[model samples]
Target: MDRETRLQALSAFLKAKRAKIPPESIGLAPGTRRRTPGLRREEVAQLAGVSTTWYTWLEQGRDIRVSRSVLDSIATALQLNIDERKYLYDLTLESGSGATLWKEESPEISPSLKKIMNELRYCPTIITDRRFFIVGWNEAASCVFLDFEQIPFEQRNMIRLLFARKELRRLAVNWEHFTRGYLAIFRAYYGQYVEDEWYDRFLEEMKRVHPDFDHLWQQSEVKTAPDVLIEFRHAKAGKMMFHLTSLQVQGSADLRCSIYTPDPDSPTENKLKKLMERK
Candidate 1:
């Protein structure tokens, strides 16, 4: 209801950004008279599919509730790039804007792909869409997820491991700094997908299930975990080094083929080999 700060910040950012642009740069006629310069407020509103009054209120730091859809449209109108778009989204959230983005996308990885995952049963694998929805999981993944199964599915977000689950938190060697960067990396990779219903539900469920995770989420820091230090507690091996690999699924922009490789000499490789032999 009261998102005045976001409106104000965005207004300032837009105003500052807009000032640098000349009307001629965008092919607009250099009107005979201009006050604030660079394509008037009316022009911006028209281009952004918003009413002039709405745009004015937004720039003036007034209380204006903006939906994610409208923000996307405005970002498009302003020609924001990936980082800029995310920053804009963050600004709104920082201002206490409460419209959570949670769009749902059905699992779409192929049955053939599932078979491929089965073929690599020795390797831990899972399929997640852009919004972090877990569509599929191989045996290795099942162990980790199963450990956390008591947590509600809607809130089974990966970020919770950093703050909520004490055991998992212990697994992360450099918890504090690692989390700071990982949060940003998460936003960079997943912020674009946050407007989905599934994502919103995921956050809500996480907040309900683990208040600690919710606290970290509120901090809004973003970063990615380092590749080398991440270790996993294996059900069979006790503990193992996992190398995460993500292969982009062509044609489907959101789908990623994620695989985990245990260290060659680590007990995991031997354990996996034994499983394959048993099969």
Candidate 2:
């Protein structure tokens, strides 16, 4: 993990990924027919405020020194999060540069949250930590979560579920759109606290359990709180639509409450009510 060549490989990979980002994506209009498929070297150079030669060397995996200012500029230009930025630092740092020590914290959902889950058994709600760990969930969330009691409590991660569960993929009406935001939320939360071993463990599990997620993560496409839309085949109301609303806990910084809502005038509301009434 602390190898120079490995860091170089990561840098080269970033350079390649950055090269494909279109100027239009960053509000810079495409000027004319270009040789490259994505943004030109000079375009990123101008935005990043570094010599084209240095950035070129960075892309080529050549030896060059990086300044904090320039690195920050590049991070902003590439829209890298704390993890991705840390990865960049890891890649560019000299061997034995001493990486930031990642710590392990409980960040578990509170007992009150557990009680709330029990009381709100009618709604499919979950109480997760900053790292998206499912510390508390109701029977309703379990039903929606699709196998709550079976999966290891530690392995009950939202990102892992999106990739590992066949029902989550097949049953979710708009999987691609819904799943895209999970990483965004993950990245955004992990950005604030990068030293969590649990976060790394979750990441490792994601890479091992789901190759598709691994590929996307490697692309360094960090998402920052995206609106999530999940559709379901309701037992009573037929097809349904659900949107998750996230809110930070008032006192505890680590916890967040995510409530699922049905689209207005949609069958999902009625279906949810029927499901609740049955139990």
lDDT of 2 at 11: 61
Candidate 2 achieves a global lDDT of: 0.64
Q: Candidate 1 lDDT, tens digit per residue, 1-279?
A: 223433544566666555655888768988888877766877778878999999878767676687888888777766666665776776665532223432344456687888999888667776655555456677756554344345555555556555566765655445664454445555544444433334455556667986665555554443332344346654444566667666656554456666778777677777666654653
Clashes of 2: 2
TM-score for each of the candidates: 0.51, 0.71
Every model: Cα RMSD to truth: 10.6, 4.9
C-alpha lDDT score of every prediction, in listed order: 0.60, 0.64
TM-score (C-alpha, index-matched) for candidate 2: 0.71
